[model samples]
Target: MGTAERINSSQRTLPYVEIMDSTLRDGEQTNGVSFLPHEKLMVARMLLHDVNVDRIEVASARVSEGEKEAVRMICRYADQIGKLDRVEVLGFVDGHLSVDWITDCGGKVINLLAKGSLKHCTHQLQKTPENHIADIKETVEYATSKGLSVNLYLEDWSNGMKDSPEYVYQLMDELSSVSTIKRFMLPDTLGVMNPLQVIEYFRKMIKRYPDIHFDFHAHNDYDLAVSNSLAAVLSGAKGLHVTVNGLGERCGNAPMASVQAILKDQFHAKTGIVEDQLNGISRLVEGYSGIAVAPNQPIVGENVFTQVAGVHADGDTKDKLYYNELIPERFGRKREYALGKNSGKANIAKNLEELGLELTPEQTKRVTQRITELGDKKEIVTQEDLPYIVSDVLKHDAPEDKVKLISYVVSTAYGLKPGANIKVEINGQQYDGSAVGDGQYDAFVKALRYIYKKYLNRTFPILANYQVSIPPGGRTDALVQTVITWHYNDGLLRTRGLDADQTEAAIKATFKMLNIVESNL
Candidate 1:
């Protein structure tokens, strides 16, 4: 089907999505990484303002002096801006320590963690249900007196509700009637339940406490976090908890991107999710946290919406038969076609559409076979390198190889600046350039840009992105591949180059960029 005829069948009127960003709180708990005081404040502001997450859990109160200082700065900013209600902190059940810390930090809301499972209550706390109930009551009462809103977390409510229903019901009964309790946040602490269990447990709670607001939090131990979250919502959950890119402890929390998409598409649920900002926000979190987002991650992963099989690409051409509700555009991405062992003429055609080129059926078949052979050798073939593959397959010089790099010399030493001298021919015209820069690659690009702007009188494309990759195996002389993306007035242009040396790989790709620009001109 034509792009003009595409329909957004995923969206219908649904309950508003309540986004709770945990990037500062649970996200910081990621091993070996901690955002400094100002970093937490910066992320908090961005989460609330740019991404428009409804709520943010800034930090845990009383964790450490650094944590306290971080929350203090965040709350100071949040309070002056009247976002006190939206900024929350996780606090323990310790009597005055948590409450005092939160108040001092200018935090208004506290998610008080309490034991729900029988094992934790009996083993960890070594207290009976009645005694624990009294402790919670005192803590809630104290927090209320301090003008802090209280939310109780039945730490492992699912397990408690299943194994010790009597104790769980009695505690909920008392807390539901408490004058200071604003909400009851239920957590499947160990992530033991399925969707059916979530439905059963949530129904019981809603029936028992008809007036209380309940927020359901999920974990992905069973990989059913998304399904169970939906089940909770269907059974009358007032709100749900989500972390951007699923940044949490073991197995990660439910990914906000997937939860938001599934809810809006299948369940017809509405959320305040800025559908377009999902990728950028995920990238920012990945960069700040130093965690590599897996390529197969549900919503924001690189390959989630890509079609790798040739049959799928062919089916996509015929009214988009291969598509489901998760269209890439919905989450600020585009569908991509992969060309490798599984590719056919259809996949090649789809990629050709993007590069503004077409080929005869015979030529496309030949190119597909060549890609498959390369894939069999474990070589990744990207669309940026498709022209070179086609040139090898059809012997046509790729239509954009008018510029070629003749040779280059670059040197880097321990205590000295990096420098480079490069020679290239553009449109059969030779240009020699040299420069010293932050690094050899930087020097090379600067010299090339000088030649383009000063002598050729042309506007150089900005390097939007540059990435280098080598195969997983350890080989000192392994081939390095460099991909460069150039941004100009019309749009972006990408090119790839491969060589045994890293610097040569980058230089080869730069030469391809020059040729692409010349061809366009």
Candidate 2:
């Protein structure tokens, strides 16, 4: 088929496309990312059971004992859940070596790798297309004989179609008759193809091999993986290969969350992905990979659902004018209105509603002004900080805090456990406590816990998370901001504090948390 003819042809709609996650295999190719065996098992279980992707490629055959162990563990878990066939491993066409390695690890499926382009066949593998085909057939035969289903990867398939269409055809023609080969995975190995090229090339492949199940694997070198993936689907590809948080070699692969979102929201296509679990899995992968997800990244980013402008917040109240099909609730997240220089009264009102606080028009104006001033100075104000901002703005109207910090002294010496002495007032009753701990912050928390438990006969909230940050530019004298998350009454509460010292900032945040708890009581 010619390019124009293929491009102009009627587009086909797929009711559903299979999702094959390669976070453990191809995603591990990302530099400085190596999941421990247990971590690999956790990710696999989550992908297969919780997120419920159609398939998972767990590891490459024979990489290391560690890789082998990870694959084995994943396979065992999958088998226990009756999902053994959904777990696949990448293997080479080296006769029976790759196949044997996979079968030894209890893998039920092998995705066989083969050279797709004439350049790769002749230069990289130093073999003609005929030689490469023979190796692949041998491996497929062996893998089938061992009772394992097989899929074939056309490595560098994008360049193969562009530079050597004849070679690609010859290989496909030879392998199309292999009943044992379940799927043909076409990869843009160098991340070179644009969406237009993808549509053109994919149409040709689908037209020539109508009976074949083709899975498109994309890379993000040009930041076009998601677009190319959509194009491939629109052009009739039956499956897609993706990684969590786009973790792969070089730039990365198409991220699972993004691909799923676009498929559902843009194309109106269906998949097995559990949309609500996308954010949780993304965070899990981010923690394991030590690669941070950008705050502005779509769907799973920290700020994607936050409205930063006053007009946007106003529009939201007027009928959700700024909302789209990608609602945060679909992915287990909530929309937030940011309080900053650009945030007008609408944003403040929205935040106040979330906190269950109602204020007079004039009181809200004062609070908005204070927030804007803080924002102009580049200070971050979260929804958790709104109550404090309101209390400060309308001091006479605000009630006295039920809890307050009187004093605290934390000390650390080279060879001794850190010690803390603390005095606090709760409902006007003063209490003193002292304790030793592994660190200064730990000591301080221990002292507070001692006071709460011994004097007040109360259970302290569990410290769920703590984060500290300073202004950019590596300024040593910059003020520190501490944010702490606490688990109280079967829910989570967050508080923020700012100070010149890190410990002091954390202590301030702790006091805020205590007051919040006391107020509820």
Candidate 3:
């Protein structure tokens, strides 16, 4: 067939693209990432119900008993909701084993994996093209007989298109007769293709068989998956394969978030994805996979929506000059201005605006300077830490700590719970308290609580979280930075301290919190 003959005569200006999220199967190929059966089911539900992805490949055929159970669980739920056709399983070109495995697990679709590259077909399977075609024919026949719909995966299709176009065309020519095949999936198995190659090759395939539904699966070996996917779409490809957090083997597949964003913004193609649920699903996958995404990963990363430069925040205030189409609100996230040495007055003002606090111009300048100084010490200033810093910098005569820790002795022995004895002063009144706890810091907090409740008649703030970190290449005498978050008055407060001992560092942070609470009171 020639290019002119293969072009779709009724093609529209912009194609309606389908999104197939393989977060469960290909995403599980990510190193050190595995979801439990229930976790897989939960992810499947969210991807289908919340994210509204058109289809989900749940698992590979006959991997393990655990994988089977996970697949079966997801299939059961998908079946109950009348969406069993939306769930698919990856299968080999084995005659009936893959088909039977999928059928037994309640899966209705089998994405049969076949070699697209002549090298993979010849070396990986050590079979000639003729024999490989025979195997795939038998597999398709068996799958169809078992009442399963089928999609064909041309694994390593990019290399195939480059090095063995004849072999690729030959395989497609043979499989074109398989009328039950729903779609043909082409994978850049080695992550080697660039956008130009994708466009060139995809156009060739589309021109050859414009009638066949084609899906492009990209890998991020060169950080080009998103670009390549867009190129494929521009070349008239019909579908995309993606994973949440870009989880897959090696460099992973194209990230669902990035692909969706580009398809809508650049290509003007439409997908069924609900943009608001993208971040929620990304976080869920990250937690289950135990893989922390880079802070700068597009769309769903932690700092992608953060304005770290003062100029950027300043532009944002003046009619969103620094903003783009990828607004944080579109993904159910709020923009943040980082507080650090790089932060400018505009950045501080932005944070203050979020906190609903008004400060004089001088006060804002002093606070910004103090934040920069703290940042110079490599300290992280969270929004929760701003009020305390402001009070400390503004008050010339530091407010007397109404509740003061006069003395404390904490000890941890080999077989006993840690114990603390503490003396505190409140309004010139003295109180001594002792307590035992799971740790020395816990005991100290308990003793302090005793004084607050019994002697001072006040409510102590609840410790919500505590984190301790030593600098890189930690040494025995290295300073430990302890940041403690406290809950008070329906809000959160954070304070930090540095010392050689972790417990002492926490205590110093607690002392800072004490003064903060006192100043506020």
Candidate 4:
């Protein structure tokens, strides 16, 4: 058929998009990432109840003791709500191990992995394709007799389509003709298939067995997981396999957010996914899995929606020329303008809008220059530092240098209390105090609090966060940076202090806080 004919045929099948999420199983298999039992249960509920995934493969049978418990807990919760059939487990060709595991765990569906390619059947299993098919057939028969559904997985089917199409075709033909197999999972085991190939091969399969349900599974070896998944959907594949945050073996699986977004926006395909909860769910998965998502990762990434270029921010002000169909707000996030070397006046204006600040052209230019200089020195500029950038660049005579720490001393001996002495001047009024704290910086903050509370009779700002960063090749005293967050009536403000000593870093941040607070007077 031609492209239009395919499109017409696809549109007719658009109402039947299927999404099977294996984040709990395949995603948890990410090396060095393990989800706790409760986390496993939580992610399972989110994938089914919140994201509305059609089915979730919670775990692989015979993995480990913890995995068994995790699967058991998830099964119990799923079975409690009458949605037990929506959960599945990965089972092997070893007949009873998987069957009994599923029966004991209260699982209803088993995705049985069997040889699809001739190479796997002959080389890996050391058996002929027909004999291998017999084994899978018997396994399915046994499971069916036990009142369980079987989904057959043709592992490495992508390569089978290329090198051994006949073997793949024969296997599909056999399984399709079998009543025990409920679904056929076609996996690009190595993530080697391109969009055109996915379209072509999927067409071949659907034409041969239009009645058989095929679920397309993709990997990200070439970073084409989402594209291939979309192609599968467009080519009339009934189900698509995905993982949360694209977490899986090798490069990962197609991220559920990307697939859902593309389907809903481009193809007008509808999924039961609650689009708004994408961020929260992604974060929960990340925290439990201990996988750090890169900042530029699409959809659920931290910086995906942030505009870092000045021109983009400028366009955003005019008509949103920089905007794309991937709006962050649609996925429970807000757009932000990054402050950096590339951030021009427009970027500055965007930050000012958030901080409720308006500066003249000259002031804006000065602030922008200082930010660029900081960027040149390889500094990360966060929105919290904008006010200080403005104050430093504008340099409106320094405002009397109201807060000055004339002298401070901290000593950490072999076995002695960590004490700090600080002498600070606020508006030419100086106060000196000494205090001991749990740590050196804590001692300093305690003394400062004494001066601010007893002497000034004012409420000190609340510290919301504390972050410290060293250069790439870390050194204990090599210009350590301490960023402190303080909240006042206006809002929260972040101030950073860098120095060779950690205590000095805290002192610098304290000075910035004093200035920020005194500026209002």
The best candidate in terms of TM-score: 2
Give stretches of model 3 more than 4 Å off. 1-12, 396-521
List candidate 2 stretches off by more than 4 Å: 1-12, 395-400, 404-465, 472-474, 486-492, 500-504
Model 3 Cα shift for residue 10 (angstroms): 14
TM-score of each: 0.86, 0.89, 0.80, 0.80
Global local distance difference test of model 2: 0.91
Relative to the true structure, how large is the alpha-carbon lDDT of every model? 0.81, 0.91, 0.89, 0.86
The positional error of residue 472 in candidate 1, measured at the CA in angstroms, is 6.3
* lDDT by residue (tens digit), candidate 4, 1-521: 99788776766668767788999888876888888888899999887787777889988898888888888888888888778999999998896889888888888889999986899889999998888888899899989888889999999999999999999988877778888899999999989999999999999998988898889999999999999998988877888999989999989999988899988887778788888788878888888887877888778887898898999999999888999888887887778888888999999899988877889998888899898888877787877678766767776544455788889898777687799998888888889988999899988888899898999998888775576788445576588888887777756676788888877887898788778678766
State residue 109's C-alpha deviation in candidate 3, in Å.
0.8
**lDDT for predicted candidate 4 compared with the true structure:** 0.86
Candidate 1 weakest lDDT stretch, 10 residues: 4-13
To one decimal, what is the Cα RMSD in angstroms of model 1 from the true structure? Answer: 5.2
Global local distance difference test of model 3: 0.89
- Residue pairs whose backbone atoms clash in candidate 4: none
> Compared with the true structure, what per-residue lDDT tens digits does model 3 show for residues 153-270?
9999999999999999999999986899999999999999999899899988988998999999999999998899888887878889999999999999999999998778765688
* lDDT, model 1, position 367: 85
User: How does residue 28 of candidate 2 score in lDDT?
Assistant: 93
